[model samples]
Target: MTAPPKTPHPLLFAPAASQGSVPDTEIGRLFHEMDWSATPLGPVEVWPQSLRIAVSIALNSRFPMFVWWGSELVNIYNDAYIPVLGKRHPQAFGGRAREIWNEIWPVLGPQVDEVMQHGRATWNERVLLVMERNDFTEETYFTWSYSPVYDDQGGIGGLFCACSEETPRVRVERERDALLQRAQGTVTTLQGWFDNAPGFVAVLRGPDFVFEMVNRAYYQLVGHRPIEGRPAFEALPEVRSQGFIEILERVYREGEPFIGRGLRLILQKEPGGPLSEAFVDLVYQPVFDVHGRVSGIFAQGHDVTEQVRAVEALKEGDRRKDEFLATLAHELRNPLAPIRQSAKLVKTPGLTAAQHHWAIDVIDRQATHMALLLDDLLDVARISRGRLELRMEPVALSSVVASAVETAQPLIEAKRHRLSVTLPAEPVVLTADPLRLAQVLSNLLSNAAKYMDDGGAIEVQAQARPGAVAIRVRDNGIGVAQESLQTLFQMFSQVSSALQRAEGGLGIGLALSKGLVEMHGGSIEAHSDGLGRGAEFVVHLPWMQTESLEGGQPEAPQGQAALRRKVLIADDNHDASTTLAALLELDGHEVHTASTGNEALALAEQLRPDIAILDIGMPGRNGYQVASEIRRADWGRGMTLIALTGWGQAEDRRQAVAAGFDEHWTKPVDTDTLQALFATPGRAGSSQAGPAR
Candidate 1:
């Protein structure tokens, strides 16, 4: 038997020179080696025209194509389809479709069977395909089509498939999903930090102060009430009346921070909860957006109710202490008058030389010392109670320094201390009381003199600066200790050693000076390079920017002292009243005395004295009432009323004015002061150009 050599399938071979049919692909070469006559489809030339045409189209195409041909529905695919078949290539190229695709058969069998059995076409977009590739099942997606091919009988023979894998696109979406999860985890950790913070923190958006974010502390602060995505006023209505709303709006508009310490606010946190008072130290800071515009506010603070309540509890004790100091000052002045009177009385012409020297010593050493001590105590008490008031005027800083230097010159000379003063050539103007301003400088100078070695040098430098004037009183004396500097300006605060205590002050000179300086809208600070290294005190006062002084000290009134006038004096303290009357009579003025306010009123009506010095604390009617009565009388209208009181506080002076007094003086009113009042040319209720010191 002679076996004829098998002819290879024409569609799989390289295109011949005349035909130009087969593609140059792996599948093309494999198709020529494939024995189709032994399989169900048989040889390519004897195959039905429709089947042959389908095979020709499948093998020659460049796309990933497959042809399921003949009644057995055999598998056929191109070179582009080998990657999709995975390990099933070559063997699957000629096998039955159902047998080759057994793993994904449930999904692919119906698409194939419908097209082949019913002669209909089927399409699938992004269909799932679990296929073994490289000996492992891979999760893949594909877009595929199955179109029917007809035999010569006009019946469905097989399905032609065009397919593509969508695996790469699906894998990218999974990676994106993982990234989103990680971002959410980071946000959660940041939110956890905010929740556990100690202070109440909240973020509010816009000028409305709407709560956009809140933490655990903030929630507990409002009694664990839910508050978010709502305006602060609407969520915490109690804050509206406390001006919190206004502060928030202002901070948002101006981009400035608003702080409130111990701010009392009443809130009803829970339903039916009683309105409770809360004191918080809160700050409203502006929060800007990415565009650099203020978009919200960051509210944070702590509750301070306990601290505020403790301060409120101590107010009554403070009041009683002030009263005790006032009484102590009044009692000390009682003995001072007799000592002063005895000193003056011993100065008579008949006295011996020894008695004269003794009297002079008593006057110089005892009386003056006692008087100054008493005055310092009274000044400190007044300052502590906020009773000191400044009579402000714009005067040259040079003039003020000059006056202050004069006040301290006596002590400076006694100590043989070298003093130098540097003033700006251009005048520096400040709105302050010339008397108080001078007192501030004098106190610092005296303090320096007392603490330093006897001959130490002191310098007073006044420099002009923008918006303020810096007056520095520096001394090459015993400098302050580091611990003492902090309490130097506190009333009753002293840090002198045993030897330094002999300076004979109440340790309140700096304290009083600080009070007066502050009242004039200035600040005082103490600086030192440690003990014995020299000290410097700098005082800065807000200065007026003008070429000239607005107002200044009034000049002394002269000639009126020689003019005699009738005066009425009244006092509950007999020694004070008689000594003052005797002093007035020494000035060649006729004087009358009364022990009570009623008696003074009667005397004023009866004698119609030119001047009336009414004692404030007297039996029966008070001096204020007596003054009121005297002013009502037609004959007493022209009388010059003066109020004398141990109570020389600002309020007391104001009351004196209300009572028709021309001037007011505290006790221990020196004879010179009394004489000066009459010398100033003015009646009651006139301008205080030059009154008693």
Candidate 2:
């Protein structure tokens, strides 16, 4: 069919000058200057026709092309392929294909061999290759095709290839993808921060104010409905009537922010649910687009319902304060009136001793009543300020009851109430403030008598339980109203009539009793069926064993051990000074009374008394001054100074010690404790003010 193609002189990658005097193309010019003998393809004059024709096709092609000639696969390429080869240009022209592309030969060599051996064409698109270019290993991508070049006799001689570097396109696409990912992350972070903000926030777009986004707080407030992409009126219809839509429209249209504080709204918690009142501090801020045009309204708010209600509650408390001031003035004048009348009666001519005693009783009773009321008020002050201290010790419950009964007896007799008493057969002991416990029970008993009509029955019962003792004070008098029972012990609470309030009712005795009982690990509760059905006040105190004293000193004296000692009593109140001196003398002690500190100091130096009891608030000089003066005297060195004060605060006790007093006692000290003070050293430390001594 064919007389075999013309056999070219040599298969040189570099064409000879005779071959159109070397190709005019860029690769041809480069090939002619290159040394072909240095390659396996030898010289330009010796290249075979198949190799020469392949090189010619590569050199003249507008597309990128490469040619490998001879058995060693020597390289030759076109001008368009120079940029694809990168820095491997002129030097690669005469080198073997495998040697020139050694960085990628592992993959390229196999493709070339497939085309040369099978006489087939192979194509690879965007094949990834790591190659050295510009002194660095570059991540490169290329599209390539390889075909076998046949010689004059139709036998394979070398490989020819066409390629395009896809690196630039691939790099651009990768950069765009990275940019998009960064944009998405930024948006997600901003959205997250908005959703977790402390206050509620939402976004509504368009003239219709379509819901675009809502934070968790805003979503919860609006009933957690599917609101996105919906109009505000459609999603939250009720809020439309509440002016929310009107404000949103104003913000969007005017590009201005709207703020509404303490705005009241009636809103439903869920769809089709009952509406409830709420208050909010709302803000509607306009969101702007890149063009600086208003695009949407950003709604933000906070719930202030509790803050609003607290303001209302404060107003109510102010109203109560005014009422309490009015009640207090009326109550204080009640005792003053009786005392004044009794004083005038004592001045009457030819007054019988019995009549004088009656007047004295009236004055004494009224003064004592006023003193108890002041004590209750002071106790409340200490309780509220957390300055109250408890002197706790183990004492017999029977003894506590007897002391409480003694304190309440005057009030019960004054009211002419029929009193009944019941006590446990076994001794119920407790670790508590015995004085405070007595005060608590006495307050409850006195309160019952004060509230009850004359001759009304009152009961005092003590029951010992497994772990506690309960003292019950019940009266068949004016029972507490059902509503009043709940707040009966609340401080400054008003429930009683004007008459009851005038009868020395500060409305804090029960509250003070509760506070004192609780300090000693006890509880008090009041219960009643209704007003006039009779109210019952019960106090429960933890029961403890007396044997657990653990070798400690006895809590109190067991029996009366009267000691005769020379004693001086000082008080501005004549009745208090005389009454105490008389009591001391009755116990077989030489006693003297002083109406002031100067009188007491004179008596103390003359008598050189074993004990000097001084009143803290006397006229000429206070008890502390007298005690200091007495302690400085040589004759007063051995005498014990006991301070009597109306205030038994911790600071008061400290001042007493600094003034050289050996003991400090609050007013109206128990008769038994006073006698014991003569038998033993009193509680001496500044931090203490009890009968421990």
Candidate 3:
């Protein structure tokens, strides 16, 4: 059996010096100086050996340590544990544990009781505790362990605890975790923005420019290839020689961004497919790592191929327009020189009759040439503006061919070219604008004549196709180039400047002919082996099924009868009014002239003229006002009103009729048309007037 331990003598157990001498810390000094007679644990000098040993250990500890001794569970802590006590330090040194930490008694009571009653150790990590150490209750966390303390007889005395406050570290960890979550959310939002962006976006990593991240538009730009994670050049081998790879590498190496507009690239569009041209407005921006070094490039751009092509086309059109203007000036001046010289020659005093006649012929021919040029220009304008009206009529194809040959005979014979005409055995009939059909054929003949060398052979062949009549004009001289065939009929387009200039043309005949042919629901095309290899222009017109040519013909106008009438001519131009009056007077009609609207009205009222010709632009009052006033008068109501003016637009003709005019004629009016007007009834000697034009 073990021997029972005996208690030492009081003098031997008690401190020989002061109680404060046993502990070197502040808590030790306070404990020794305190009056413990009033506590259950009694005086410090009479305390049990276990309680003294534990108190000494607690007071000397550097780490936070606390001792709860005897039945009252009085508090005693080290210097490091003072912060946990807050303002309860000196008082809590001798205070009961329950009272000092009453705010947290619910949590602390079980752990303390387990260690005290069972003599078992209790361990708690990061345990929450709420204590009223200061004026306010504070939230705190501590990692601590409680171990039982024993007295001299081996019975449990109280609990000794070792602790560390973990409040600051726990709060720091929580804040760090929250920031990481927010950072991840921001990254996801940024990725979403990139995916939905309108322009193409891509990310390339490393020196090989490997595609890392790409958006929806980026896939479309590259024809939806599975390119992500692949090197750019390896995915699009066609772009290897296109210099895009070099550009991206340069941006990465230089750490600078590159922006390009309308940059050209040749791409395959599909795997192992033929290459096609592409244009883009792009930017390559270098991405940097934390060390301030370029790690990759961000590629973003638009496929601007259509816009670039449109801009290029516009530039070409502008250049062509400039060239056309220059050509127009040159052509217009060419005729003026001869006309001026001929007029001077005709006025020479000693000129013979033959010489005067020759001079007159030269002037007439040049004037007609100028008129034709102006007519072509006006026709183009009217067609472009959708104001030209075609007179539809049923006509035999033979008649149209005869009319066209008659009109083009002068040019054809002038070139001294041998022409062959071939037509299908069956007569071709068409419901077409007769004059316009003849005009289309005449233009083709003239074009053929102009492009060929003198005396070149030409052929005009017509055959009946399934649904149409095909007329082809073939020439053996200066054939059109294959490349120029596509743009041959474009307005003001010339195959070659030297050829067109030498041939004396304004470069609009083919374009005008094309417009006229298309207006008749037909198509025209040109074909040639190559330049100098001969060429052919083919015209296709819709066929009409007809039996005999009995009623498929327009009635010819009756011959003008020899009738004299009183004529009134009003014009602001003296030369125009005088010349017109002279022509009508020579036709045996008594003619009067007026230079203003007021004069015209006075003359009409005084003479009650059979026919009144008025100009739209006049002083005091315009022709519309004069015509309106004339129709309101008594005797003037029976007179015929004719508007002869320079304004020839469809709107001008409508306005002329609205102003009570019987006819609207654009100047310079054809002499034959004016003669036809004079032959109408109710002009001085006739019974009744004809219908208004």
Candidate 4:
């Protein structure tokens, strides 16, 4: 043994143990114990100077560090890197880098090759690595750097690495980023809602009340001025004197909210324009900072100028109504006084037969005049309340004209006006309410007679036009002023001069005529040059061709009987169902009724009725649910489903249609309307009752 020690080769000799070349650590001890001859780098003593220095540096570092050397890329690491290795620790101390980290070799292999082949350094931050640790793959993150170690000949020999696990910090940062994204999304959504808010919304900041934010409605209220970032009082100087600025100041100073209801403010809506008054119902809520000190104010309100003006108009209307009532009383007393005198005269004894007859005629004429006035008033009221029912039927234009002329002949002859009637040679037929049309025509003719001077020329003409007929009533009379034409068809509206000349009228004839014309899907207009220029009233009515009227069963003709058919009524209210069933029975239709959605479905399946009128709000499943279920059945596919609900809003109709209903009808639907539905062509005795849902 002494001879062998004396003969030891200097090239393979180990460094002195006392020299402490290796780090005095766990990985250092393992590195010292590992046999380096098995690796491509061979023994530690034979390692190149550059690699020795790199390994020494890696083993001594406080941070996790590693060394990959030689063509095999053998692994060498410090004590700080042991936890990174997990169960591969002691065994992985001096093993091949790619073999020891084969699971992540694909990720790190290229990076190592780059540094080794190019002699360049590589740095990566928060690089993700799924590594086997504690006998299980763990999700971890790390930041590391790889620098080439040069040999004595200035050639790349190995890689020196320094790293730190970033798993906890990286995960925390990712979570924070996700939270921030959600918060940002919420802010964006809130901003959208604020911009589209219906009411005027604004925010003011600081004691000067600078405009910080404003919505679309606010911009409209303020006339689109460039007011953002400017002081409220400075931008809207018109509002300063109106006490709006003071109100905002008070809210900001005292931190107390103020609700202003119908506050009147005079503003200059346009630059250099006249000041106008506006009313607003608003609230000034103080916004506080972190210290609970008032920072600004939030303002939201509605422009109530129309409401204020409407209240004033209502007051004026009440005064006008009072005047009208007084006039009515005086007019009524005038007729009553004459009737009383006539009655007394008839009752007097010793009166001649002629005198008695004259007195009786006076009473009769006055009573008839009073009855006429009451009838006009009643008609006006009924039309205003939408209670006037039109009995629509096929009628000849000649017949309507004759009926009107007969009604107005007494008035025309009494006025001694020269009248002319002209019509198209070919007879014109229309689907119209004959009586209503006659009434409209007669009212115009009577108006002409009443307004015209005696012996004035009156002309009634009817001409055919595409899709309509034009009926014109022209008269040489005390014509209406241009300003009066606009309101001539309004209720209780009359030209003052015309009223004076005509002696007496309720000022509703033209209004009633217009209403009647509109109910027939027509329009009426009056034209005149000016006072004493002769007025003309024209009515335009939609007309049907003679062939269509004669060939087909009347389409939606008023009061026409419907074909016999099967009908189902589903409603929760017993009275509504019973009454509707009775009406259908009267219309000659077989009917079945149910009070619940489920019962309706059962009855619908059993009968396969042609029509299903269902109440939207029903017990058990509701009408919408029942309608959907019925629509799924083969037998129920062709049935017409009508949604009969008290809710008649446009949204309600949309929901009903979306729920598979063919029609949406509001409660209290007219019997005639239902009859019209059944009378429609292909509505009964056909596989399909209505338009498919």
Candidate 5:
């Protein structure tokens, strides 16, 4: 019931007639010849295996090969195509090329079919393709070259293809393309950011170091069109003449980045024209190419014009500060010298009552002047730092003005200038700080007197304006400059250069006065024509009344009887001790003198004086030590200890208080206050003594 398969005859292996039959024609012989030894065909069997051998040889070859039949992709074979097919078996021998790889049909099928139909050959490179293999997997690359195959009848039968598998090459090429695209995008973004950056940026290239790229700011700064692709020397030839080209050359040669800040660059519109200068901070960084070869330089910078100007302003302020301090020291020391000399002269032991009284008064007035100067200095510092404290009270404007005038009278008398005052008969009241008001008026008056040369006249007048009171201080003195008017209220800002030499000041007085006036809801203004003319300052303050009026009377004056008691003075300076003793004696007080704190303490315990004035700085046992010893003494119960020294700082006063002194007074003591302290009713004529400097 089963059928057996038949076996082939041995004779069938022998060469057949088709294999042995050689063509007599040259074309037939050529087609049948096997020139390659690796081919699996004998010379006689080549004809029968011609088509098969040709197809096999083409498949094994490195070149891509395909066959098309008239407008249709029939067969394709290639060694390079093996990998593209991945793990797929070679069973794809006779499939429709288009159907197997339809994804690439749009590009490869259309072009190859056209060549076959038209009987022509076409070649291309970098031709793109996306196709699926026999396994239905996607592949993307390029295919090229199409040659039409003709039949024996001279008609186009099919097309043969030879191409290189460009997938790897194409992928690499796409990556390179992406890198270039990204680089371009980065450059664009950098350009935009640099254009608006606070600093300038530029790119320079070439042996001549020309500017190749410049941002918007660079163009604006250069004030000219960019010179791209031009040599730096040629584009900015003027720089060569100005030595800037040399700097660039040095940087380039060293292959190092260079940075320069606060460099002054003067740019002129035309040669020999006035230079418009600007300060700049700059950096030049070397740029390299793909091969790491130096290609050009990139420069970035900032314009520091404003910064330079501000520094100049600060320098000017420092200069004014120095000048003011020097003037202050000179003015304060001048009065101290006379007070010391007069105090020494009064101690000669032959002084009459009138002469002694005059000497005491002179010492008192000079001491007060020094105190006022120190007060002004402290007030200026406080106002500058916004630390000025005001004691607000209902004040009579007349009293404030009168006090200020009285304080300035010595300076006025020294100048012998005509002084006039005009005040309303009716009282003008204001809710203000009395001491600060007096200080403001005093500063204005003193400033006027200091500026006037040869004792010029001064006028102080006040009037009621709409909702305010206007106080005017007019003086015939060297006037301020027009250019300085705007900065008149600026601290440490002096007048123009011309006026600084004529009238010296720290430039803080007016500034402090202005701030004080404004803090009280008021404004101040300065008016002047020019130098050698006159200046007038006007202060306008709001007029307001305080509600409370009780407890407004001035305190009664202290008596001078205590000042007439015997007083002992001790100090290291013989002139200081002797003059102080004589000055006390002139107040109708018996005086004894010692040259040291120990001597004064000894005399104080033995004499049991009413008061003791101690000098802080002494050779042995300083006045503070002396005062402490005296306060602890059995006879020191009612004795008042006063500190009189050059150490006038606030902390010094606090230390003095802690050391048991009743009051602290600086050197060049005001004789009037000293006399009044001694003259108090309960304390007057009591035995009091003081330590001297």
Candidate 6:
């Protein structure tokens, strides 16, 4: 059988070797020695040299590959192609196609056979192949081109393929699609919510720019149809003439936002008709682009016409209240002045004992009424500002009650009411302002007298408790209505509806008493069954340790004789000057009266009076000017200058000192204090001068 040399396949020998030339390398010699015709069908001798060279070039050219031929598949390539086959090794080169590529064989082997059977080329084909290279691992996904090799007779032979793994690129594309879908959905939801928002919204470009986007509320406010891509002045031409254009231009140049409150704007609807009006509180905010450059502006606002009108009405009401107070003070004080002066004048000299007592009683009664009115005025001013201060001390409840009853005796007697007073056998002491306690008692007694039409009894009682003292004033008179009880202590608010009744007052007594009591760390309450059943007011104050009592020396008797001296009294009011001069004269001092500042100045220079009393409100020149001139004069330097006026504010006292007055006294001057002033000797009088300006 070996007699005839076996014919080798043309693919197995080198071209030069087939021409009878010898190869130089050992591999070449080994190739020549092998008998290809006698070898097994699946042996390595069947692999062509051309096939090996082609695979090496493909793997070295930056592309990965593998080959299958007639039931055998091999990774006959360079180093770069080896790892792509995963666990498959060089030993797998001659293995059966099923054994080497078991994971991908089911799909890949059939496709390769299909190309070879048809003798056609498959190009740019994509496939998902989960292939196991070794027993341990799998790889998926491929894109490849397959071409069938043809014999010279055009018979199907093998498949030539090239592949690229594309699993990472496919996954990345799918995830990107999902994120884009979510972002689009979120944007749609945000737009829906913003459109239905309650507040007006608009996007503008610069100050006078038209709204690029607007919500429903913005349309309702502007009324006019909006022109989207135009400036504000172009759409609403009236704005140019209304000064809005200038405001916009300035804001754009300055890059500042503008916020305005209660701005009134007029809008035009049509020709030859009244304009539409609006009061707005508006805010402008500068808008920035992603690069942080100012690109536009946003505007929002509320219509406040109704609110502005309401505030104007409130201010008008406040003005009327102030006017009423001024008028009341003027009208009330005019009549009070004459009555007060007449009472004082009636107390003068030489009368029968009965007449003297009658005159004194009349004077006391009128003075008390005037004092009560003045007190009410002061209380209202102080309470309104929360400036009332209480001078708290250990007070004797019984003594305060006694003094109040004595003060109100005339009123009680005039009404013919019986008064009863009850006090603890032991002293009832309370921590309170003594003067304020007396004031509270006097107010209650006065209120009771004013309310009662006929004679009625008033009973006052004081009792001590473990930690507090209680004082009660009970009156048998017309009582407060159930509805009015809650508001009885409100200032300027009267309980009785009858305006023409005998109770003529500013309705501040009870209110002031309540404030004073609370300030002393005490409380007061009013109780009544119903109208006309009678009323009771109870005051409770905390008890504190009592301090030792030192009875103050009895105030020196007023009207005491002093060395007679020439005294000039200057006052604008004739009655005040005359009454003051009369009182000084009775105190054994020679007195002269001047109703004008110039007259007083001339008199002081002429008479060289020992003392000068100047009124601040005199005509020609005020008392301050008169006093300055008198002090500067040679003859008037020795004379004492006293300011006598109704101006009692701290600033007024300061001005008096600046004007060179030796002393300052408020009007309805305390006669006793004045008398004591004249009686005291030396420069002690100068000590009473007020603060310098």
User: Candidate 4: what lDDT?
Assistant: 0.83
Which consecutive 10 residues in model 3 have the weakest lDDT in total?
684-693
Q: Which residue pairs clash within candidate 4?
A: none
lDDT of 1 by residue, 324-433 (tens): 35544544555466567767768666988887777666565556667666777777777778876667767778888988899889889999999999998886877778
Alpha carbon lDDT of each predicted model: 0.79, 0.79, 0.83, 0.83, 0.70, 0.68
lDDT of 6 at 113: 65
Ranking by TM-score: 2, 3, 4, 5, 1, 6
Cα RMSD (Å) between model 5 and the true structure? 10.9
Cα-based lDDT at residue 287, candidate 5: 82
Worst 10 residues of 6 by lDDT: 19-28
Cα lDDT of model 3 by residue, 1-693, tens digit = 999998664333547354532556677667667778877788776888778777767776789998898888988788889888889877887899989888789999998889889999998999878777788877788999999999878888888999999989878877888888888888888888888788889999989999999998877777868889999899878788888877998998899999999999887778777778888999999999999999999999988999999999888778777777887887788889999999999988999999999998998788787877888888888888988778777677788888888888898999899988998888887778888888888888888888888998889999986679989988887887778899888888888823454665777888888988899899999998987878898989988665346655655458867478889999999999998899888889899999999999999999988889999999988999999898887777778888998887778877888888888887787777778767755554232233334
Off by over 4 Å in 6: 1-371, 386-395, 428-436, 465-468, 497-500, 551-565, 595-610, 619-621, 624-641, 654-663, 670-673, 679-693
Mind sharing the TM-score for model 6?
0.50
| TM agreement with the true structure for every prediction | 0.52, 0.74, 0.70, 0.62, 0.59, 0.50
Which pairs clash in the backbone of model 3?
none
> In each prediction, how many residue pairs overlap at the backbone (N, C-alpha, C within less than 3 A)?
0, 7, 0, 0, 22, 0
Give all candidate RMSDs, comma-separated.
19.4, 6.3, 8.0, 16.4, 10.9, 16.3
Q: Across residues 1-693, which tens digit of lDDT does each residue of candidate 5 receive?
A: 898987533222224344323233322233344342232222433422323333444544556555544334445455455565555424343446666666666776667667766767888786656555545655566656777666546776666667676879877978999999999999888878877776778888955787777777776666664466777667655556766676777777777888887888776545466668788898888787798777788889988988998998889777777766677676777779989977997996989989898888888778876776676667777666666656677778888899889878877888888899998776788878877888789888987888888679999999975478999999998888887787888876666543455445556778889888988889999999987788899999998533334567477585425435667666778888788888888768887777777788888888887667778888778887888787677677567777878665556766787677777776667777787777675553232443221
Candidate 1 local Cα displacement, residue 447, angstroms: 0.8
Q: What is the Cα-based lDDT of residue 65 in candidate 3?
A: 92
Q: Write the per-residue lDDT of candidate 2 for residues 1-693, one digit (tens) a residue.
A: 879876544334433555553457767667767877876777767767677777767776788988887778877788888887777777777777777777788998778778888888998999899999657898999998888889867888888888899999999989999988898998899999889987888888878888888889887666667888999888777777887766777788789999999998777778678987888898888889999999888888998888998987677567666666666666678889989999999999999999999999998877777777777788888887787888887777777788898999988998899989999887677887878989998888887887777899999998987878889999997787887777677776657542354354666777899899888778999998887778899998888544244464365666756667878889999988888888788889888888987888888888887777888998888898998898787776567778887887777878888888878878886667677766664322122322312
**Model 3, residue 148: what's the lDDT?**
97
Model 6 residue 73 lDDT score: 40
User: Mind giving the per-residue lDDT tens digits that candidate 6 earns over 113-149?
Assistant: 6786776666544466776565565446678877765
